[model samples]
Target: MQMKKVKIDSDRCKGCQLCINVCPKGCLKLSNTVNAAGFQYAIYENESKCTSCGFCFLVCPDVAIEVSRKAKPRVEE
Candidate 1:
């Protein structure tokens, strides 16, 4: 099975919430603690529910989000 991963650049985020709104899986959310720029940056909260659809990346204006999938290696007997 392949697992999806999301990476958000907190420093670059402006708390626009565009990515959070576009996420189909509801995997992203605004952090309670603000970033250095004093904005509540988006963070990936739900790892199991994410489908790696790249919707968040497409919507983020600041280019702060990255989505990737990692496949587990198969073990041969």
Candidate 2:
């Protein structure tokens, strides 16, 4: 399985939690730590369960979440 990597911009997050609710794999959670804007940010939890489905990214009102899949290794000639 391809590993999914997610990057979140915590400063821009408003703690809306829309992304957290929308994650199918339960990969996101609200952090206890707050960002510079005084809002709790979304974090990727249980990363091994992430499918790179992009539900979190699409639902983010803050556009804080970015998800990418790890590329598969190429077969050498």
* Clashing residue pairs, backbone N/CA/C < 3 A, model 1: none
lDDT tens string, model 1, 1-77? 55349989999999999888988889888899999989999988879898888998998899998889767699999
Q: Which residue pairs in candidate 2 collide? A: none
Q: Which 10 residues in a row give candidate 2 its minimum summed lDDT?
A: 1-10
lDDT of 2 by residue, 1-77 (tens): 55448889888889998988888888888999999988888887788898888988888887888889877799999
Top lDDT: which candidate number? Answer: 1
lDDT of 2 at 6: 88
- List the candidates' TM-scores in order: 0.83, 0.83
lDDT of 2: 0.85
Q: Look at candidate 2 and tell me the lDDT of residue 37.
A: 81
